[model samples]
Target: MSSFHIYGHRGSSGTHPENTLLSFQAAHKAGAQGIELDVQLTKDLVPVVIHDERLERTTNGIGFVKDFLYEDLVRLDAGHSFSSRFQGNSIPSLKSVLEWITSNSLMLNIELKNGRFPYDHLETKVLELLTHYHLYDRTIISSFNHYSIQRLTQNGCKVETAILLMEKLVEPWDYLQQVGANSIHIECGAIDEYFITNTHKRGIPVRAFTVNDPYQIAALKKAGCSAIFTDFPLVAMQSI
Candidate 1:
């Protein structure tokens, strides 16, 4: 296997329902070194592994995820929308994912989805869970909401934190230093050899997101990216 990390974006989402345990297991079977997943608090303040603030996109449930309690959220079919083969797969809690992860050596990148609805104590809650599971050393916390990332650093969080970006910046490393972030997780197109090389010169790692094309994957790897988040881990692994 290549030294470059290939994290299954939402756990092999290209082949399975995103964020479900089934998807996670598939990523593992495909030899992914890590998995990147989204985290948001349920109505009950229980953190769950999902990508959206609303349920309509990935789940059978209606309305916002904040309106449903964890118990109610789990009862809904999380995978049926993807395919009939995944008819019974329910939304996995952060706790459940942590428990499952104990059985494997996969590293985790947990993206705090607080940009839409800022969940109360989301940073502390996720930190507590990581503490309980003894996963702080193996996890990387990232967020589009730089405030949450700042909160993690200000509170002296032990886990590595990365800033998620959608656009190119003149000097992203300066922004990273300002936010006290450990690394960068950016849109794939926004990164190139110069960007990756310059960022690495500052001793910062850059990981691109949602990169699925084999050509792009090879290019990023050649550019010396620390990692690439892809929906097809097997294809990425093969490309490298």
Candidate 2:
């Protein structure tokens, strides 16, 4: 039987701090086949692994992440707020995560967090890094901003593209082709037999996000989901 691919959401975020190297390492150790993480650019235009535009939520820092230089941002503890055990963990660069992905032969979903803060040249910069590590083929670039997805394809990004959506679309397959996306990264609740069947017919896969429940995982697999993003990868791997 074919099983749904299990991707660690924010790198096993349920156990470790989200988007940190430790969290990614934990996810890999937990047997996740792939990992999904968010990336934002600093003031220096250096790509860093982080979820929010602001730093206060996940790190021991103040102000927007884009306001700081790469040198300054690395000093902040990215893990302490989650737990004392990870007090010294710092925000990792995209290079750092790329290295891990390459070394482990893991699939990567690099979500460009450019919806609110459209960092200049973010698409090119991210692509440059992926090319540097020769990981484009193994990577899937996704974004909530359809423009970014469009821009990636425009810039000759050969990496697979997926558009993240939270709301219903009248013609999702049309939109997917318009943006040159090979897959749809969507809210788990929005997926059902009809949605799956329609997209599958077009040769597009559907990946559900942030799913944690065992029953939901099983149902998604039964519905022929291509993969599932979960905070608890070990649990998802075991349940499915």
Candidate 3:
């Protein structure tokens, strides 16, 4: 059963704030076995953990996350929409997350959001960070951008990689095999039991994203999914 892992999507985003230390803490407390987070580099080449190209949705800041330096990003309030419970939280660096993640035997699935990867020194820099923390074995790199995953794997990262798809895929396993990825991080809206079955037959595990509803979680389990990423890790722990 591989322990039927629950990965907190952008941390326990439903209860705490999204993409902040508070959210990841809440997820860990909520009993998530892993965390699924996005990584985008700054102009200074800092790997910051966040989702979205723009900061408008989650934080009080405007403009692109990639355009800002690490100092500029750390000053913004990431928990603006979540009320007083998490008022001062800021978006954390990938380095910050690596330090905290070592306290437990938790797994990390980091999504590379940058395009045009094989990105000069970017892949090496990311690998250096993971190696610094000695977390290569406990981590899995994922991406919708196949090149990023390929670049990282080719550079001899000890971690495995996962392929992401937000749309319905025909012959998805072919994509996974071609990318040298053994796992699929599927969008919940586009998956079906047949997809899961076909993926499983190829010895690949399928995990759906952002699943919160009990019925949907039950359905995913019945459909033989390997895992799920959820905003509601607390709800998921209960449902699963």
lDDT-best of 1 and 2:
1
Residues 1-240, model 3: lDDT tens digits: 444788899889888888788888888999988988888887688988878888898888899886888999999998876776677899899899999998888788888876633335556777889989999887878888887777666666578788888998789998777777768888999997688778878788888887999889888887888889999998998997
lDDT of each: 0.92, 0.91, 0.83
Candidate 1 residue spans exceeding 4 A from truth = none
lDDT of 1 at 76: 92
Cα deviation at 235, candidate 2, in Å, is 0.5
When summed lDDT is taken over every stretch of 10 residues in candidate 1, the lowest stretch is 1-10
- Candidate RMSDs in order: 1.4, 1.2, 1.9
lDDT of 2 by residue, 1-240 (tens): 255698999999999999998898888999998999999999999999999999999999999999999999999999899999889999999998898787887899999999998898788888999999999887999999999999888777799999999966877999988887788999998876778888888878889998999999998998889999999999998998
Candidate 1 colliding pairs: none
Which residue pairs show backbone clashes in model 3? none
What is candidate 1's TM-score against the reference? 0.98
How big is the positional error of residue 206 in model 1, measured in Å on the Cα after superposition? 0.4
